[model samples]
Target: MSHSTAFASQADLAEKKTSFTQLSANAWAYTAEGDPNSGVIVGDDSVMVIDATATPVMAAALVRRIREVTDLPIRHVVLTHYHAVRVLGAAGFVPEGAVNVIASRATRDLIVERGAEDMASEIGRFPRLFQAQESIPGLTWPTLVFEKELTLHLGSLEVRLLHLGAGHTSGDSIAWIPSQGIVFSGDLVEFNAGVYTGDAHLAAWPDTLDRLAALQPQQLVPGRGPALRTPADSLSAIAYTRDWVQTLLQCARDGVAAGHTLQQVYADTRRVMDPVFGQVFIYEHCIPFDVSRAYDEARGIANPRIWTDVRDREMWAAIQS
Candidate 1:
């Protein structure tokens, strides 16, 4: 099979303007035109970074932003999930005083299971995102792991890291700050961007989303896109994400029930998804993987298969065929 569209992101070499928007006194969002975002929480004495960027060099940009506001050491790095784009930059924060790398127990498990493959896979897909790819040391390991929920005090500021449920990945976590009614939702929530459910638990995504909505955060820093500043916008982001997942799963289910081929399901899913989400950032890059996973889950595959550079190409070729 021939290559198709070059991953849709290989050509996305244009730089995106980065924004460091302050959501609250303690919370700031590091967003770039729909790229994965990182969250910053400043306490009285230390700082915490949520979702490190794709590479240490990329993470240095976040550190620059953090330093502009405070000289406090970055004491913690939280992994909302195990995606390489989000975790590989943990080491970048080490110099900034980040000692403890924290993640949910399940996220740590995923790193052990497929981290190396994912690291190579993601770097290939989005070359521009990994600015200085050579700077990456290896798969990021979480020094501190928690089960369902873990709460920490960054010098009196309370931050709750909760493993809400399976959605974007089996080990997705969200950082909630009750004091400011702010939450940092990793890839579990996206606004004005493609919701990549390439390794998602589609059937359980909605319910997990429900749990996030129950938090009623006043402001939310999603995994991508701009920060949601209003409670209304936060709800909209959750609703939009749910709609994306539900619509794709429904299309996959319909196609599978009709005994259609993967290519056929891809066409069917696009016919429905494109009209609404086509214009978003990375929509093209995400569609193939998202549709493939949706098809798998619809066919009763409970766990998402590990993605390798080879498997990614094979899957892409199959759908293109």
Candidate 2:
């Protein structure tokens, strides 16, 4: 099938080349051409990982990369959100002596509400990312959950995880290292890649981006791009994501105001978004879902609806029709 006509990501088969880039003394990023990125923080005593890959088998690759830098035990695995692609790989770190999986209370709530459905939906949507699908035990549950913010001491280095606001998802959280002026933004910021808003807060996303920018991070690890080393590059990533969100929402609003159907709205959104984001990785895969969610939000859907495998096919058909 042509990439444009195929179901989400099913046509994508090529493996991405991964890079392990150090952003600070304690901060590192594992990015893969435009695939989901993971963050590694090597503390004085222990280590912390943000956003596990899609499956336990996939996460082993990340573990190997971490071992190249430090033998420190991975004590903590932090979930930036409850997406299956991000959290289902927690079990992979268990063999490395990772004891605790951390996430915000809102994240845990999301897992309770729709984690299973999301897992099934995502596995069906992006087959390649799942790698060894049989290796995933089940939904990843956080052993430690907190509200608003939580502070952890990996020996002497302090890592702060804060749920600043809802953007990517209502449960979105970020890891901030105050001493090093570094931040790990999970799927909240995308640079030179498609911003997936399939389960996002379209209207609140820009404001959440503002709160993330307020941290004034000297270095940043975005969800889907290369690590930003300079403050200027960090801010530019934020602006890049903000512009995408705002532009997408505006297109949805304009289409809805003109009484366009979902298909019509999708076409209208593509006309505007494609010119700029068309060449980005996963652009073809993400735009359909992004347009669907934006259209729903513009028509007064406050909360994102659950997406199951059945729903995924139905939506794909509706847009394609």
Please provide, for model 2 over 1-321, each residue's C-alpha lDDT reduced to its tens digit, 9 standing for 90 to 100: 133677898878999999999887888999999999999999999999999899999899999999999999999999999999999889999998746999999899999999999999999999998999899999999999999999999889999999988898999999999999999999999999999998999999988999999999999999998889899999999999999999999999999999999999988888888888899888898888999899999999999999999999999988986
- CA displacement after TM-score superposition, residue 191 of candidate 1 (Å): 0.4
Residue ranges of candidate 1 with Cα displaced over 4 Å = 1-4
**What is the Cα root-mean-square deviation between model 2 and the actual structure?**
1.4
lDDT of 2: 0.92
Shift in Å, residue 41, candidate 2: 0.6
Error of 2 at 278 (Å): 0.6
Q: lDDT tens string, model 1, 125-208?
A: 888889888999988999999999999998889999999999999999999999889999999999999999999999999999
Backbone steric clashes in candidate 1, count: 0
Superposed Cα RMSD, model 1:
1.8
Off by over 4 Å in 2: 1-3
TM accuracy, model 2? 0.98
Q: 35 in model 2: Cα distance from truth in Å?
A: 0.6
